[model samples]
Target: MKRHASFLGLCCLLIVAALLGGCASLPAPRPVPPTYAIQDVASTRLARIAKQNALPGAAELSGFRLLPEAPFSFNARIALASRAEKSIDAQYYELRNDGVGRQLLRELRDASLRGVRVRLLVDDLYMSDADELFSSLAAYPNVEVRLFNPLPARSGSLLSRIVFSIHEFGRINHRMHNKLFIVDNSFSVSGGRNIADEYFMQDGQANFIDMDVLASGPVVREQSAAFDIYWNSEQVRPIGQVASFDLSPEQAQRRFDQWVGGAGHGLPENERDALGRTSVAHQLDDGKLDQFHAKAQVLVDDPAKIMRGRMEERFQGSVSQRTLAVLETARSHLFITSPYYVPGQVGLAQIQRQLQGGVKIIVVTNSLAATDEPLVYAGYARYRKEILKLGVVIYELSPMLSQRSGRLGEFGKTTGRLHGKTAVIDDKRVFVGSMNLDGRSASLNTEIGLVIDSPEIAADINRIISIDRYTSAYLVRIGATGGVEWVEQDSSGTTTAVHEDEPETSWFIKSKNWLLSPFVAEELL
Candidate 1:
């Protein structure tokens, strides 16, 4: 009987392996219909403001507003959506099916209902829970939903699909990390935040300190063109083509109503009123910006980057490469904030060259206690000492022993992990977008951001994040005996106590990470 059971288990294992291996597949590519962004918006409210107040071709980089506060940043999207006249094109790495996410969807549906065209492109990694919602949303007239680099097997859960379809690992491993949102091709917002409660600071469990740049003028048009490229790429599949539209138009309408109506986590009426009063639409209606104006250019990775073998030689013009090229021009202080930081050997070499050149560089990243990915923390830990010894200033976010005020103030009350991917050079140029200072963002995932040549923008970003770095993070440094130490800071931004170990992390976790970090690949983080 024991032999029989062992033989049965072996057969089961063989069958599972066969099923997994069989999932390795993609048929001939389905031809994507070409669609370009609507560039003629001479009469729209946004165009009136953008064109009137836009910096001339002299500056090159144009209208921009930094969004650091979560509530205000999120409100900006709704404001744009509410006022979109002709079209709204938005894409993101993730969109949770939570309250705020559903609210955003409802806004899109409402815009579509008003004869405004709506297009949403999302990465397929997190769509297992939201695929049915996408199917329903796609049913609305004038609303289109698509997935970029969709996983072939969608019937099972995301994990099961990955387990069964291990054959498509090459394509499945790469993803679209880019986030771009445009209204009427006149105004746009591009940055690290996805359409989720945590991104917007509504997540009760935890949140991210994120950044985005809302812009107008020439930059918006360039952003629209980038969106067109992804929308027309063969790798992007319409929601209907990828998932069954089980909900009919009538059924979808009722469901959409339910989804939107059930979302009770929207901003309070008073906060909404405050945001509306200060909206760009409100300020721009008079044809000028109460915000900073600067020269800027949009950078985006090609969608085809994810459609091919990741090991293939990379091409130029990638967002990261372009941003780094801009960084190469840095002449003074360099400030970098990447929540999931694992600077591999190549990145470290580059940093060393800059440090050797006397660049005052400051890096702010998540500590082991605050990081969302402990395995990623393991990867980051592999080079933590090497990085510290290179004379670079490093600040790892500490959620437990931090004081708060302004945007950084919320970290003390709620769990806050740094999610802003930003770098400022000499306080003259700022790179804000979705690119992290890590191998995954550098090569595997597609990214987008603006390289702004504006001191005003850079200064504002530096000011807000500097506040967080001083108050909410541990200053990692080489101790007297060559060991690492975490220096805590007071609310007054003065260094106080020193801890010999990772302040909030347990010994078991630290030991496990120390032991397992050797196998954690930086490129996969």
Candidate 2:
């Protein structure tokens, strides 16, 4: 009888255990999405107010206040040693894609660990991957990470997107489109490069055409200040504060190592590596920037409260300030290089007006072959002919630029992609930063750039753009005879051209463009 009782008890326990297991719910898995891939105008009324009441170094750089290249003191520092001096360097490090991007990220991570204040402001679109190796860096107490206009997407379907507003939808199409990294208010790296494998050329050695400017002068301070505004803004969230993510350094380190070791972790390994190298040991000591020349003014378009008699809302003032300055100041020539080009009717009209003013405007953006975001290209196509009619020249990059440059030597194929947003006016001034020449850039996203007034610097930027224009870019030409052609140079140092009117685009592309055009889903691109 005792043996019988024991067996019955055991069976009842097993049944209860099974029932409990059935009732328990498993945790949901994190979502991962596929990799994918701004503007201005205005008048001069505010210019006088800004000029009269601007920051210390604002005026000289804003409007043709030419500073002769004589010995002027600029702040500089070396890695954790020395005194402050001017940074006279005209040529800064140009890091594109993965090769240098990984190094940069590593450097950022190290800088934070050593008690050096670090700030990372990325356009929210680039931070979709929850699996990125940020926790290790985020583990550092002084480090902060914020996403611009980050709205998490829940589903990839179009219906899901439409049903989901920018407020609730999983896909946030209108994003914060600026990329900035400021360390210790002394050194910075800004440009088209995002913290990704492709931008750093670490993604299969695919050379993503990108640009970065490493600045150390007073400009660094200016850049950092703008970064601080975005850092403290509502759009950003500290990495540590992100819910559902609570990991200590030891745990994060293990995860990072697994990621770096190819344990099937999804992040681009080199970006993590870059984060590792930005140690506090690399902090610039003062006296290092003595060589940098020219003063700089930081132009930022942050959303700020605008009150109009009992109404208050955020305005993209930075966009208005910077773009209006550039458009109004453009004299003989205008050079624009943006990866994404979407000019709606108003935007197109603005360019036309600029053209009517007799400015030679040349624009270089991504082609269907080179662009990662096809939907953006669909929107761009709507304005291509109209833009050409208004005397604006357009060029699209080839996907080959997406392949790593110089990694495989001269014999390897070169894909010339344009991943930089810059503007040069009459070889007198240059603007470089995260903003693009698009509607979203003008009204939706927060953007930042440097308005540099050094003739030598402008010349260098102009040369770079011109080289890319004639060599790496395709020329969309409409002659006086009304002939439209997509002209390109041959690989063998020859010239060959194709006309868009000739049905040159493959049927596949035509169908894809057709399908994506109607959606007007400007947010995703």
Candidate 3:
């Protein structure tokens, strides 16, 4: 009886110790500045940038040019950074420290060295080892770096961060999904592509078929305004404050030079020349670059979106709201391209309403085989039949399609995945930005995009969509018996029907998706 009692006591002691250790492993919330200080910074920065860059009736003078190709898009950003005489502000959802990221960092560093003030804001959820590099970059005199919604403990490993996220899922899951690059308060690029190798086709294994719009005039100022809001928000912490690494300016510069100089060593000479020749700076200096003019408006979610427990009433003028307003104005047709599409009941109802009004809707999204996020695909898969029944034409991109349509250099024997998020409404307006047509984009994460009143741009995007439907995507339709079928065209102009969710998807992948779909919460995807 005494031995039994001692065993029970020992078990209780172990349980208590385990509980204490678990609590200790959890991340402690970092301290932030006082509310007054945060408010002061926000107000001051907003007012100052508005006064300096805002023009009277500036909307009438806005202009936009589509950077449809990845190489051209990459070059445009580097050129803007190289030519920026006054300031450069950039914000992104992810900034991997790969070859493409290093090259852009080098450009920003060179710009700073030439007396341009540079501010970079990046989301911290996927920052990984880039924290130290950002810390080093911030050591430059004319440059500053801030991370949005950073993890509490910078020393924590990825597994610890995941555990912390499970504990604080509500706050940590909501991210800033905005991508903007503004230079000199005059030019900007806002779209789906983040700063990484895969985005620029530098990743040999996989490359994203993405899009960006190069804008000047009024819209650029609007993007800068959005950047200022995020930059000054309380959630944004300086890299120097969060990262433990301490390196002097000279050391940082040397490290940056070494990284940048070593990039593109293995690339073929032709590809290297292609990257070098498409420089916007060279074209602008030679007076050969063409600029298109149109009325443009920048739409972005409120920075307060990152705050937890906010009422839905607070999201009155959100990016999604603005997009829906534009959609309401659609009279003839709507074309949407989203990589991960899971339109819930609200979206379904909206499309049904549009269909009832005789408005044609066409959607292009990634297939199960082409998607990088199989869980997101699972969420989207359940809605396919319902959407097809509602008379919405759907196109699923195939992985076998090469990225050869948009004047982007041919990636030899590469698999294509849809990553561009865009919409063309009635061939009158075009939207290109970082907002995905998923539940997370709708009510969870913050997003940003540009609405350009340019029929030419809308028509161009529509043409691309039509071409992709025939060449690189499968048309999903309901059969006579209420089943769904995928129709694709062959190289010899022959059409075939594929009676599967994704014809090219592996059996194991299909099985995994089938097993996981029943367990996933669609709204969180």
Q: For model 1, give the 10-residue run with minimal summed lDDT.
A: 1-10
Per-residue C-alpha lDDT of model 2 across residues 369-402, encoded as one tens digit per residue: 6665555667787788878887887877755432
lDDT scores of the candidates, listed in order = 0.77, 0.48, 0.71
Checking candidate 1 for backbone clashes, the offending pairs are: 61-294, 61-295, 61-296, 405-409
Q: At residue 213, give the lDDT of candidate 1.
A: 81
| TM-score (all chains, Cα) for each model | 0.91, 0.67, 0.85
What lDDT, from 0 to 1, does candidate 1 have?
Answer: 0.77
Clashing pairs for predicted structure model 3, backbone only: none
Q: Which parts of model 2 are misplaced by more than 4 Å?
A: 1-105, 121-125, 128-132, 147-167, 245-249, 257-292, 303-316, 400-415, 479-483, 490-495, 501-505, 521-525
Candidate 1 Cα errors over 4 Å, as ranges: 1-29, 56-61, 264-288, 308-312, 315-317, 402-413, 491-493
Q: Give the TM-score of candidate 1.
A: 0.91
The candidates, ranked best first by lDDT, are 1, 3, 2
| Best-to-worst TM-score order | 1, 3, 2
Best by lDDT: 1
What is the C-alpha lDDT profile of model 3 across 229-326, one tens digit per residue? Answer: 88888778877766755567788777767767765522222332222334454555564444556787888898887674653543466787678778
For candidate 3, the lDDT comes to 0.71
